[model samples]
Target: MQEAVIGLSHLFMTVFLCCFANFMVIPAITDVTMAALCPGKDKCSLAIYITGVQQAIIGLGSLVMPLVGKLSDTYGRKFMLTLPITFSIFPLVILAYSRTKWYFYAYYVLKTLIAMVTEGSVQFLALAYVADNVEESRRGSVFGIMSGFASSSFVFGNVSTRFLSTSATFQVAAAKSVIALLYMMVFLPESVVKYRTESTETDCLLEKPPTKTWKLFKTLPSVNDIICLLRTSPTFSKAAVVAFFSNMADVGLHASLMYYLKAQFHFNKDQFADLMIIVGIAGSISQITLTPILTPLIGDEKMLSTGLFFSCAHMIILSVAWAPWVPYAAAMISIVATFAQPCLRSIASKQTGPSEQGKAQGCITGICSFANIVSHLAFSPLTALFLSDNAPFRI
Candidate 1:
């Protein structure tokens, strides 16, 4: 029994680390799959459109993402982390079976719906759990380590799924998720500290029981509450804007990268996946090795500034140059940027009280989601217009 308890504790730590890693994978998976599945007639164009549409779908989910955070805060964190995984099983099965373009669209829509709960909320809850459990002195290291695992998972998942047949990829993804679910069920504990309240009325109104997660988001927080929160908290307001721009830049770069490859150097789907895998691995290393060491040394503000500056420089270089080393240079810069993410997240966490972490994270995700929606809507048509077979510049 003691051994079993010890084993479960270890499992919770693993799940805590890997849950966000799993969320980090959605983009890498979508990128590789669209590259494989999109029709060959104007393949680059179709791929961008498909990716954009998918992003827009996920963006809509992001708009409602904070509800999950708030519910988890009011109720419990473990349930929030588990809810999305439970909901995701069916859509992934559908995604696995889908072949036609209409089926692909349907699957993506389902994915978007599930992502609303999972990508933003699950991670927010998980981070709250971490903040609650880990000491402040070590929180940065813990977050850095979790980010490393998540990025590593992205690298491996991209390589493995990208190489597999679409059917095989789906099967593998389903299996991975099932394993994750089972681990959570058998081993993970409720990480939230117990809180006592007087009235059942508030509980009845707010508490979203784990079993009835389907109804979790049925009741909405008022628009006035949102506006008041934004106005009252400058940190939340500024974080929201930062979240939006950051996601816009991230999604725009991702959606355009494959086309940029084909347009500039004429690489195919497999080659692009390989490059992504390499870049993902580099990012994983940077987040693991460089972040923990650098963050404490330079602090979040200076570190984030330096990271963003380098990332912008790389984007400019990619926009202009198509040399053999361009991808390598770009990857290095992006890895530095990736290293900064967890640090920024930790800074955001410190801006709010412990109880409000979920809402704060949700606000950030919601803003970013809106940004992603805009970028996707604009990037697809813009890419098509700017880069045809006869265009002068690749970007």
Candidate 2:
């Protein structure tokens, strides 16, 4: 256990710092986007529209993740772990330096292309890491504990952004990514022992290794494997669909959240940070405690469904929130809803054999990617349209 924790320390620490950087980006991007796109307008709905475009790229970027995950299974987790963080530095630096819409557009396009290899995939990687290292019997509890630490990074990250300039924050994030890479290079060992052994066993069975690159390419999962992974397992498929809807709801909220609060309540960066801090604290606590306690009593499926119902409640409450504090109330009420992702991961990871954990997570990430495309196209524009003069939900 101690050795496993030591090996996973690098992975967990990197995830925390990356999440910190991500939370920092949330508040700054809205203002940067507004300044870049439409400086004169007080309520710049166009910023939301551009966010939609960026999310579309992120969604499309998810296509490569399954392949990356497969590559991790074949090669080792270190490369998949390192590559995304390495490539993401360019996009962060570009955002910090550039102000023009054209530059922003370039960043988004490049961000999409390199999405599989960045800090955004940290949670996905962490999930796989836990699946890889932990005993199957103890995975659920360990996953929750790990997720709690990861979620808590948002609190500190949000607070940090309140004091720093936007450029400084971005630079800090970029620097953190660099540090994460160094830590991984120096300390993180491979978490693919089972995958390596299983592959070796299979290779030993083969009389001779094939020469063609086309045949070599056959080592990774195909389109059929991606689809079949989702379709074949009832629990995994349900979790996938739930994750899809969960992300759809989440992206829709996120697409409009900052804008809505800023437009209605006149929330500045500090206020936005406060909201994130509240949610982050509540979520981190709940993430650590709730799933382990409930899973034994209700099992994974019941726990999942319960979390979804609470999540749906969260969305509905946020949609009709009449005052600024209402979002905070909704946050508190939905602490248990944070259980959804960990439970979903726990269930799916349990169903999958050890050797295929990467494929399972890749499939899950693929479903979320498709949802991002749909949510980006749907939610951001809808928020813009609603915030306009001729809409039904005028406040």
Each prediction's whole-model lDDT (CA): 0.63, 0.73
Give the lowest summed-lDDT range of ten residues in model 2.
200-209
Tens digits of per-residue lDDT for model 2 on 1-395? 45655556777777776667667777777777777777755577767877787778778877667776666665567767777767867878788786578887777667666763342466777788788888766666667767777778887888788888878888887777677678777877777544333332122122222233444476667777766666666777778888788988888887888888877887776777778888888878887677566666677677777778888898889888899899888887557887777778888887666666766777788788888889989988888888777678565
Q: Report the Cα lDDT for residue 122, model 2.
A: 63
Clashes of each: 1, 2
Clashing pairs in 1: 21-150
The root-mean-square deviation over C-alpha atoms between each candidate and the true structure, in angstroms, is 5.5, 3.9
* Residue-by-residue lDDT tens digits, candidate 1, 7-74: 33543454543443343344345444544565443246666677678778778777876676666666
| Alpha-carbon lDDT of model 1 | 0.63
